[model samples]
Target: MTDTATTSSSGRRILFRVGWIVLLLLSALFAVNHIAGIWFIAASTDEQQLFEAFGVVNLLAIVLLVIPYRRREWWAWLTVWLTILPIALVVVFVPDAIGITYVVTAGVMSLGQLATLPSFRPTRTAN
Candidate 1:
């Protein structure tokens, strides 16, 4: 590749990496919020358990993003999407039940994930 092309490609790679890192940070923050809600707030057992499950899913996303997703593994990306898409659908279908905050947050995270798609594109290999 020419110098300019190489430079642009490098810049894009860095930008995408930053995007995914932002996702990881977001997941961590949500995980903490969910787990803390279970302990610090007074909720019924069902609610507390539901929040705990949310926390666990967030933690799992963090791990997946940090490891295989960073490596641009297709399966890892798909797995993360599998987890996110369902929740996004729920937020879309039942906005009132989930609340506006989550609706907004889900939109932001989905946009962020979309922005980072180039990072997960399959690389070409020369024979």
Candidate 2:
């Protein structure tokens, strides 16, 4: 690649990494918010358990976001989908203000994941 091309490529990679990091942060924040919401709101035991379970899953997704995928970009893609699925379910089941929040956050996070796809190939060292 030409010098300018290399610089541009490097910049793109940095941007992708930053985007992924942002998604991770947002996911963590969402999970924390869900936990807090559960604590503040009065709910049946079953409902509390269900929301806590979802929060745990979100926490796991945040961890998955940081794992080294190397050549397996699909893993990263899968992580993004997994992160969105629960929120999508909540939106479907609730269809209220909280559901709207889940949908919007999931949408933004999905966009970030999609933006990173072009540069998602395996690293040279991983090959």
Best by TM-score: 1
> Model 1: clashing residue pairs?
none
Model 1, poorest ten-residue lDDT window?
85-94
User: Candidate 1 on 1-105: residue-level lDDT in tens?
Assistant: 668767767876886777686778878888998899898863799879877887898899999988988887878877877556545665655669566666666
Distance (Å) between predicted and true CA of 82, model 1?
2.5
TM-score for all predictions? 0.82, 0.79
Instruction: Give a tens-digit lDDT track for model 2, residues 1-127.
Output: 5687678679768768866876788888878876876787637887788768878887887767767533335866766787677876788888999888878888887787776775775544312
TM-score of 1: 0.82
TM-score of 2: 0.79
